[model samples]
Target: MMKLDICQSEVGTGLPSYSWDWWTENEANQFPQELEPSTWVKLSEVPSSFSFEEALLLCQCSPDSWLAWIPDHGEAVLHRSQFS
Candidate 1:
């Protein structure tokens, strides 16, 4: 299984922006090779301008199980069993 850290952020005004950042190549390389690219679209709500909420939701819907890394808050791992 591949492990990825998901971070969501909102920017701009009016429509509420959203943005997402996947780990660097070096970081992603640490995961298992068999695992496919992780998806990030189920943790939170969608954003009008690609806000952080959209990223969180994407992470939740990721194909490969992922562990979320929240600054100062620790981590959150997604499990198929939980949602299914």
Candidate 2:
């Protein structure tokens, strides 16, 4: 059970557009099917055993998307350029 804050880039400011926490339960059903459970981890909960590559795959994001880490903040997956 970790608090996963979903952050989206705002006007290239690298700020979070929206945030949410993850707690295994009915919440998973509420999210889009493409989002993998392991795609996120709170900034403080990032495990030492985890790797960026692993997160990328688990994210199951589109080819045009990219993941970025904002220290002390959280990890984010940038989707289409227009929305970012």
The lDDT of each candidate is 0.40, 0.43
Consecutive 10-residue window with the lowest summed lDDT within model 1: 49-58
Clashes of 2: 0
Candidate 2's C-alpha runs over 4 A off are 1-22, 34-65, 73-84
Which residue runs of candidate 1 sit more than 4 Å off their true CA positions?
A: 1-16, 19-35, 44-51, 54-65, 69-74, 81-84
**Local accuracy of candidate 2 as per-residue lDDT tens digits, 1-84:** 999998774665654434344445575456454444344433333334332222322343566564655444346665533121
In model 2, residue pairs whose N, Cα or C atoms come closer than 3 Å (at least 3 residues apart or on different chains), thus clashing, are none
Model 2 per-residue lDDT at 30:
60
What is the alpha-carbon lDDT of model 1 when measured against the actual structure?
Answer: 0.40
Following a full C-alpha superposition, what root-mean-square deviation does model 2 have from the true structure?
16.9
TM for candidate 1 is 0.22
